[model samples]
Target: MKAGTPDLATLGHRIRHFRGERGLTLDQLGELVGLAGSQLSLIENGKREPKLSTLDALAAALDVQLADLLAREAPSPRAALELELGRAQASPLYQSLGLPPVRPGRGITDETLAAIVGLHRELQRRASEAIATPEEARRANTDLRERMRARDNHLPDIEELAEEQVRASGHRSGALTHREVSVMAERLGFKLIYVDDLPDSTRSITDLANGRIYLPPASIPGGHGLRSMALQAMGHRLLGHQPPASYDEFLWQRLQINYFAAACLMPQEASVAFLSQAKKEKRLAIEDFRDAFGVTHEAAALRFTNLATVHLDMTLHFLRVNGDGALLKGYENDGLPLPTDVTGSIEGQWVCKRWRARRAFEETNRTTENYQYTDTPAGTFWCATQTGRTDATEFSITVGVPFNQAKWFRGRETTVRAESRCPDESCCRRAPDPLAERWAGQAWPSARLHAHVLSPLPSGTFPGVDDAEVYAFLEAHAGK
Candidate 1:
């Protein structure tokens, strides 16, 4: 394969290393290879790519194989340090400082290079930590959402891993049982131990040294909560995740673990088979999927996004919105115009009142799913939303698809329809002119600020986790 910019840099470093080992000056090597000293310097500094013939000649002249000259590894420890410094200086983060690049040469000792690289790494760490701010976090989330949309929100590798583990645990059908989950944990060399004093910030903790997974003593209402938490804890080990060094990494790890848990709860092969048959019968519905998998409505809706496009050739979107209209979670590969901030993040933004996600809150029937067809600027979509509640807030989970593909779903015939022109101030953002005129200056409502908006993101190796409490819990249970 052809080398990219970073690979070219590695090749250049290898060539330079070979030349130095042979004690050949640039001019002498250039003379032997029939190239100018300036040309050779350009090749060694990674400023230019050498022709295949030129590489062969240089490799022969330096008494090394072409493969050796093209190797990706740094030729020496000092060369590795030099390469790191070069990359740091070339990065946009370092360039933003408006400082001149420092060239590595005889005058620069390895110790000095090490110090420079260390400082650059520290700068990068601080820069990453700065993203914990709300605006920055939104931008990061926006970027990650775009990545998911591009891939249809499917992770084949994680799916395969979950399938292998699930099959190994002897779970071949509906609703992975609590006993099966414990068996899977045992297969991974872990024992599940429920305790009453888990840190409030954490749902579960894994003591790697002791091969124990500590969870809450009380059973969660649905029973899936504890199962999901246990699988997520094992996900870290199964997925080979390390302590995240930045907010972006922390978010990514959380997403992966959540996906893993869902995949285990609803194994892909089984889910696809079930969904395929449902589609054939024109009865695909989130409620059936949720009941079949024994997961929450939100998990079933989110998992539909994972498989719908890949297996059923149906693009879809999902939304979890609070009763107050704030978007808690969202994903779309179809052209649904979910509300977004300037940063492109949908979370915490308000959903349009005309859309089913928000309108579901106004419905009186809380037991059954609410279905509607929305005509949006992008296209018309049919959605089914189910209202749910927790001790802290009331929310709704919605799964939707394009109008053309709605025929395969169970609620496609619903006559309820509406129009939305979101991102436009007139859609739901602005009140009617008469109402605005009547109430413009008279209203002085107090706004309720969410605690997350004012607080900085949780700080530590694992964000939001209280390390002291976790350590103490582990210490107390070590002898048990």
Candidate 2:
């Protein structure tokens, strides 16, 4: 309800919990508080701000102290203050108002702090903007990662649905053929359309009301990406998930659909059997998985994270990075140390040049997967990376496991090794002292921000556009 206020979402949940505990309905609570049922419902849903008097009345009606509704057990006072400070720093409205960004560990009076937060709320109201920032994105990633870790990053529900989909389509595993995928889409009631000149921002658009899926020839022509996109579109339709209301929810929903798509492309039972056999023979390779499952290396790498972590009892991490070394996507359940500032941002941080993922960019041999063992503060991790070029950028997809688990991978015999102290100074990122001494004043590399690093957060609707615009465009292009 208010910017930088103690989590109102949590407070609202507590309010609902207390109301249910006391066996009170919204109408009953509203009556007791001399408020309307609609107002109470809005307050409970966190859609409306309640006056202090109203909160007091609701507290009285619920027989709980207001503090009980707002208290959070974790996050030390310093940490909580830092989180609030981050929200303020990332606030565009705060920036527009010419207010100084709040820095953690900076002492401020309660009066100053309240004023800053008040201005933040006022700015939000004036701008009518969604507060999606790097800080919020990191928080979202952390929340989703926690949920995935709780379930070992495996979705049994989606897996079951995928298996059922396979059986219904008369395809019992391995790889779903294009004809089978077409039949599956038809059965799901979506007519597929491929347009050679679809917008770059849109990969595939689902006009659910008309039951059509418009795909771009460039983004997904034919192969793993195409099938994955088709199944992903169908996934959104069949899984019954509403469009996301927040950036974090959008990311979570995307992953859910992608998991479903992967499940359909490579059924869990069959994939596991192949992976198990590969492991038994000590011949696990991304290429082998990709060929066997008829998916891209990226898909294979991600699916391996899903299954290997849960089924094979292997701790793993996956990363997709661009040529500029910015992490586009990453996930780890194995406590891998990734680059992050104190604010916990991850996606745009520069991957250490010495890491296998970064080395993939310089790789001339496109067919061979780059492998390396890198020692970190945590320990040595063996990673394999494959490079590929998209129309927009050249990128690499990498998967890594702890050194002990390297024996289970095909590239275990690689002699490449490097020491890394990422997110730390004095690592290989620093130019060698000898070179620096020789050319201290003669040479320098220009520092330029990678465009991806500066790219704005994807809209809550489709990947890069709002839902209304997408719908309107679809309406205009409906018949043509």
Candidate 3:
């Protein structure tokens, strides 16, 4: 009954075992312990926690020590089997099957009990393995996000490394040139090689043996993609990263390389100065930041989050949402409410329809960025969203901050404003009452399933990458 005591079920089973060994009925044991037969039955059935004094009396009457009465282990093999069966039946997974609980009576064979327990365990193991990749990935992402938020998304060590690399490349400029990127790679003892047969799974591959960094021959938009990829390849060597052993390690390494690349491209010293002067003139903007650094809008928006809080004393959020309204990537330290799954991951969740990230796709003007102010349960936030298209789909990149900080941004004068009550079904998830009434039971549309969602995550040391293909590609290129 007290803390650290054996569970009542096991204690009860022990007591019953001792009583049976003594060849005594419940009434006889009750008489010996000065209790009614019904009370003794309850104690034996684990429906009552026997007092210490009662346990002492029963122990004495049953010819055993008190310690024996309260032992943690089940008294017999049948008792252990019964306990296991009871626990398995009580589990959420078993209950979800809607099957009736099987009580282990004297008629049940020990083999039958063992088989059932083994089957349940196998089911549990398979279920855990099936979800382990995504579940653990989400959990890792959530934990990493918390750590990044705690440090304002700034890694001083990586920043220092990037700065040292930029200085060594002699980049003293508005935007890092392809020449500068190539110089940095060469300094890292890697020769940049653009090849037509690069592996599809990799953006860039570093051949450590030959000291060559292989990239695709195709031109990336604005040349920023090529530069970024090359820098990221060099980053592994600069940062001393090894091949990751687990999915979490792989994700962390990927994030580090990305941060390293961005820091090199935007070189904290110049970026902070540019942003400070913009803030001085009350004209801070993602487009200006992108143009100033010659990076993609999404890259600039993400880079802004890295420095905004640490250098500019601002809290902010950045989001990249596809035209379909599914959030692809998101980060926030400004308390801006973003949709998340049960695992606390924002990826693949739907953004509110009224938010600038989703609404930007509706604008007829595809030439410029869209700006809006949205009032939400958290607070009002002003955002600037730029819509862009890739070969596959159109997506929007958004950078936003609380209303108080909006005054320092370039798009503060936008007349567009809206209200949202997200995470609530009534906000944007539910159809209008009139429309629902008109089509409540009449609509039955087939849903288009996302392939990634339908398929299990690809299994490998580096997920989704074919090691055989990579090795073959390396061999083919080795002779070149």
Give the best candidate by TM-score: 1
lDDT of each: 0.90, 0.78, 0.88
Which RMSD values do the candidates have, in order? 13.5, 14.8, 11.9
Q: Per-residue CA lDDT of candidate 1, range 1-480, in tens? A: 384323767778888888888999999999999989999899888888888899899889988887777777889999899889889999988997899999888998989889999999998877668448777778778888888888899999999999999999999899999999999999999999999888898899999999999998746578989999999999999999998877777888889999999999999999999999999999999999999999999999999999999999999999999989999999988888888877788999899899998898899988989999999889899999999998899999999999999999998989999999887889889999999999999999999877888777776557778778889888999999
Error of 2 at 410 (Å): 1.5
Candidate 3 whole-model C-alpha lDDT, 0 to 1: 0.88
Model 3 scores a TM of: 0.73
Q: Which stretches of candidate 1 lie over 4 Å from their true place?
A: 1-131
Q: Choose 1 or 2, whichever is better by TM-score.
A: 1
Model 3 residue pairs with clashes: none
Quote the lDDT for 292 in model 1: 94
| TM-scores of all predicted structures | 0.75, 0.68, 0.73
Query: What does candidate 2 score on TM?
Result: 0.68
**Which ten contiguous residues of candidate 3 have the minimum total lDDT?**
126-135
Q: What does candidate 1 score on TM?
A: 0.75
Put down candidate 2 lDDT per residue, 1-480, tens digits, no spaces: 455355554455567778888999989989999988898888765567788888888888889887775555312443344445556666665665576666433477655666666666665643332336556677788678678877878999999999888788889656798778878888988887877645556678888788888776635445677888888989987888886656766778888999999999889999999999999898888889989878888888988888997788899899999898988788887767887657665777788878989877776798879899999888999989999988898999998999999999998999999988876767856678888799888977899865645565664344466666566678777878
Question: Sorted by lDDT, highest first, which candidate order results?
Answer: 1, 3, 2
